[model samples]
Target: MAVAATKEPNRLILFTDAVVAIAVTLLVLPLVDVVPEVAREHRPATEVITGHQPEIWTFLLSFAVIIRLWLSHHKAFQHVRAYSTPLVLCNSAWLLAIVVLPFPTEMVGVFDNSRFTTGLYIGTVFVATGLQAAMYLIIRIDPEVASEDTPLPGEFVLGAVTAAVLLLLALVVALTVPGVGYWALLLLLLSGPVEWAWRRRHAVAAA
Candidate 1:
């Protein structure tokens, strides 16, 4: 049996990290500066924020979704010790999705409950999650690119499955109840606790 050769591409991971960082940074762009007269003339601070509920939702949802993707990206790349051209290209597509996120956030800020806005937001998340899944497959396919400390096969599968489930849940909520789809953002925010508890139980059982 012949072992697959590993070729280290130095810039791919660094480029990927930079793109992810920028994506996360842009998530907060929906926050706008409040004019002094607007605050003093219209209503109190709480009411002013309430007037900007859509923008607030946009910021919160985009922030949560970006963070979720970034964490998964961090996890995936942490195990990967090297990269190939195709993997780099796929990752670029993934980052392209990241770049797109703010547009949907803008849509949400303007037309939060509109079907079009909800659909666009859900679609972006679905595509991003799918891309992340593809990255997982690329790493799994070329074992030589990953380090010995890479996540085990079962753990990898579990992480991928969880991401898919989260994406699907977001989509379902958008389709069935667009009004509640924004709350699905909260679902992703709460996922860390749920996964942690599940892992703790499994660890105890294994022990």
Candidate 2:
């Protein structure tokens, strides 16, 4: 029991990392539809492969995004000194979001420039961010598993929430416009500055 108790955090991180790694691997697999059956019948494989530049770019973009999430997960786990059943459950929910990332990425690759696929991709990010932020908050909420260090997890939590709201606003642009919905993701770039200002405000008020 003591050995298991001491190793809980390690187990969580290991499992989460494995899941994230698999998701990242799958993120690129959809792009490999380089030579479709039709293309094989009509043209050389080389020419058909060259035609998938857009899919390649999409895979690169999605791989970068999911890696960012993985980094965020690592950073959040750094402050976690222990865990409990609730923490495990909450982290499971967050991991579930991460695991689903490759699906929408593949969907976006298959679908035309439609609101449904773009929105689905963006919505996946929003949910993953929200659940991640909630995971950090859960550590703070239940004192039974909290460590001596408070982890100031709100930094990551609020940062993700801020980006999610920005994504929401950007989705409006997506709905109103056409062929430009993905551009809305750029709004997430504001998260760093927003989180900085938020932390500063709290630091000042607490002083």
Tens digit of per-residue lDDT, candidate 1, span 23-48: 77777655645445456686677754
Query: lDDT (CA) for every model shown?
Result: 0.72, 0.75
Best by lDDT: 2
* Tens-place lDDT digits, model 2, residues 27-138: 7766555557536678766665576666777788878888888898788777777877767876788778878878887777778568998888888777877777777786
Can you list the residue pairs that collide in candidate 1?
none
Spell out the clash pairs found in candidate 2: none
Model 1 Cα shift for residue 80 (angstroms): 1.2
